[model samples]
Target chain A: MADRSASITSQFTGAGLGRSSLIFWALVGGLALLGGLLGDSYVRHIFILVFIWCIVIASWDLILGYAGIFNYAQLVFFAFGAYGSAMLSIYAGLTPLLAIGAAALVGAGIGVLVAVPSLRLKGEYVALFTFAVHLALPPLIQQGRAIGMGGNTGLLGIPWLNLFGFQVSSIDKLTWYWVSLAFGAVCVYLIYFVILRGRMGLAFIAMRDAETFAQAIGVNEYKYKLLAFVVSAVFTAVAGGIYAHYTSVVTPKVLGTEFFLMAMVMLAIGGMGRFPGAIAGVFTVVIGNELLRSFDDYRLLLLGVAVVVTVIFFPEGVAGAFKPKPPEKAE
Target chain B: MSLENVTIQFGPFRALTDLSFQIERGEILGVAGPNGAGKSTLMNVCTGGLHASRGRVLFNGKDVTGFKRHSRCGLGIAQTFQIPTLLSSVTVGENLLAGQMFGSEARGSAPDIPIQDILYLTQLEDTLNLPASQADLLTRKRIMLGAALATGPEIIFMDEPLGGLNAEEIVEFLQVIRHVREELGITIVMVEHKTRALAEIADRILIINFGEFVMLDRPEVVLNDDHVVEIYLGKKHDA
Candidate 1:
């Protein structure tokens, strides 16, 4: 499989080709060929996990990297999506597909809730709000009497999604993988091509650089900041739905601090605010973890050291090294 | 062209009180005062950077009190800070691009203005791709001016454009400011402590003392005013 960095490099070069039409066609054909070959169950499972994570990491970048809003409770939204879907399927008697949509809506709702307070705050204050949400979510789900969120045991027997007459069973990892890949691609394209290329993207950058200056230029900081959070939450929620369906379970453990920290590490390793960086970061951290699984406890310690080293030395991450330098002036 | 009894008080200290002034179009308004005279504060209120506690700011025959800073920029008003506020992480070209991106009215269309033109106007063509943080003091000032110009503003409020420049750099900056007003027909409102320097460029000068308008007249008349000499020049003499 092509690494995230490699994929980004290819995408960046796609426009520079002499004939854009031919380059696009050839690229589509290549992706199709690769997709066909990756239809095996085990390969499909790994790809699906990667694809789902790509969406989450990308959304995380949208808020943290682009807007420079350090939201610590990002996993809360994911948990909302997973728990929302699980509850809807088990109690509301809705299909997994409907549950997925509900999860996204619920996630958006939580985004609104979070943004209302967080948007007014910045730096450590915003981080505090998000951290509070992260601490509050799991216990709320466990102790809430009316919601019946399975207390601590969590939801089970989530019905498989049926497309037309075909039931997408848990064993059909290839099908799930393809769906996730398509969704991930669409999310990345929307974020990178549409939003980042539009007026909103400029506003985000302006806000990131200087909030006072951004306001001076007529950007309503509160409106745009909320928009970043809401959009990011929607993507993250969708990824959560994929995770829930893929694993056939939804639990409080999914919203653990460890998972959120892992996502942050992925973003830091990949590059902050750069679209390609998120994808690269996720794949590197995830694959690196798997590769070092033999060391068990030692693997986590190594990951921590790696993160510290990366922050200290290569603050721009691996992609920064590959970025094209400006040509030198003629002497 | 009005401020109706605008007062801004920070706890016990009042920054501005019942301050009022009118500025007509195509006018070069020079605001001169000592430090803590609320010169920058007044500019901030006018440009919507800081909201006036009890007054409305009218721009082009409309109330702009509620408008955000960028909206004020859209309404044909822009400003440069007392301290240069260039994005240190980005290149000079990127900084200009950001300004063009925000300041222009034409939505959806990418900024097509050549980076070279911006650099040329600011005398920074040689340093187009250099990181703003790496630029020297004078270069950073020029880049700030260039970024403001890239916005294509109809009116620009410059806060201490010649704050810390040497004689040679000040001459260069004066020429650039003159060229901008002449070439683009943009109205300039400058805040400066160097009365002689501003007198040479400004059409009209407004002297501010304790956040109140002390004198509003031709630069020569304001400079020669006995009160102006007694308050500002006398302090310099005493020091």
Candidate 2:
């Protein structure tokens, strides 16, 4: 209610209120320390998953939560990044590291393609259009067998991330975990600090809350909306690229409804528009997911119930509950 | 700023028909009309809220008929709604800052006038730290004007800015409007129902009736016309 994005951005830059900053650094340090001490490959794999999902969910939050665009094509960018990076690494003979960077460019280009026409459409129409693209992508990719997309089976044997002179193979779980942690940190830093902390973020929140007023005051809605799409897409695609290389597979199933719903749940539970909340959400969900593995098929049903409860009870997500109340006015 | 033979048609009904007018710089023009007289429509056309069915809108001798709303705002045109559309969650200061960041110039440019000066003119200096939603109606209205002034527009089209104000608040708002014009040398086109209030500040009053022009003249000349009286008070006033 007190402008979630604005307050979060202020807390980010306000040296007088460095408490959140301290907490953020502690979280980063804790994750790094845990990765170094943890010996189990299974748990390390889960942490790597968390790191990858954090980038995806945070970028999605930028568009849906902060920009208020209701963009549903987020996973499309992710999928494109995965597929593009896989193709580049395999067929183009680029190293996985360079391919991932190229994949981000591909994602940005796709973002522009989707945003140009979609930004022109009003509210729900943009969502409808983007979702249609999301729905259509798998079938379109499946039809690209000639390009070695592998159709329903997906592209296999994708290369691992090349670090310095060594290939970061799947057997080296510790190396993979550290790389993911560092990559996720850098991506989240760009999103939270570089983009959202500046005037661009102000324009976004203003356009979100009072669009007509923003337009009347000279905020170009199209330009800012396009910016949100492109920036979010760049990070999302990078996350996708990381996920693909880490797992050594690229599949059309990554664009499935379950994954999309999971991302939405992360945003809802993390606190929509609340900075760093999505990170908390990714932790709660991915960990909660692993804990519920014994429930088997009921996992989906339980997740649904949890989301419904979250929406009904904690509409602002985990971040909202922890948000500081606005200060009382001086008499 | 000027409109040449501007007409706005929605389906079969015409909101404005063959309306032509020229507004000189640094003058406050009041627009008055009956309930369906299209005063707001005229304001919308000028602000790019509603595109003209046929005609050209010119600002500073250049045709801007094809410019978008924000582009028009970039060219020093701004407006306020009857109900103040403040960004409810953001603080009052940020609302003004949003305008300054985006209006009349690109991002990172020095504002033509400081936000503090605009706040002083609008008397919203104290509410700077308050969220816009928490402010009262009068304060919200002043924030609206302050934000528009922050844009540093050459002209501001206000659609019924005094609609919900009491007499005292109206006087205060009118004083702020006058100050905005006098100090900043900006042009103002206000669509107001209260002709008497317009008479206090308007350089010229444009009267329209049933989507047609009735008169455009000095406030004293236009307000006292028998035809204008008939349009407002009916045939008995004309007799």
If you assessed candidate 2 against the hidden native complex, which CAPRI class would it receive? acceptable
Scored by CA lDDT, what does every candidate get?
0.76, 0.87
Tell me the RMSD of model 1 versus the true structure.
6.1
At residue B239, candidate 2 shows an lDDT of 44
Q: Which runs of model 1 end up more than 4 angstroms from their true locations?
A: A1-44, A325-331, B87-97, B104-143, B146-152, B233-239
Error of 2 at A171 (Å): 2.9
Error of 2 at B141 (Å): 1.9
Candidate 1 fraction of reference contacts recovered: 0.25
For each candidate, report its DockQ versus the true two-chain complex. Answer: 0.33, 0.45
Clashing pairs in 1: A216-B69, A216-B70, A217-B70, A218-B69, A218-B70, A218-B71
Residue-level lDDT tens digits of model 1 in B1-102: 456677877788889888878876677789998778889898888887788888888876889887767777766677888788666655666666666666
TM-score, each model? 0.86, 0.93
> Which candidate leads the pack in TM-score?
2
Task: Give candidate 1's error at residue A188 in angstroms.
Answer: 1.7
lDDT of 2 by residue, A1-331 (tens): 1222231123223433356546766788888999989999999999999999999998988898888998999999999999999999999999999999999999999999999989779989989999999999999999988789999999999998899879899879999999999999889877876677667777888888888888988888888999999999999999999999999988899999889888888888888777878888999999999999999999988988998898888889988888678777455
- Model 2: residues with Cα > 4 Å off, grouped in runs: A1-23, A326-331, B104-109, B237-239
Stretch of 10 with least lDDT, candidate 2 chain A: A1-10
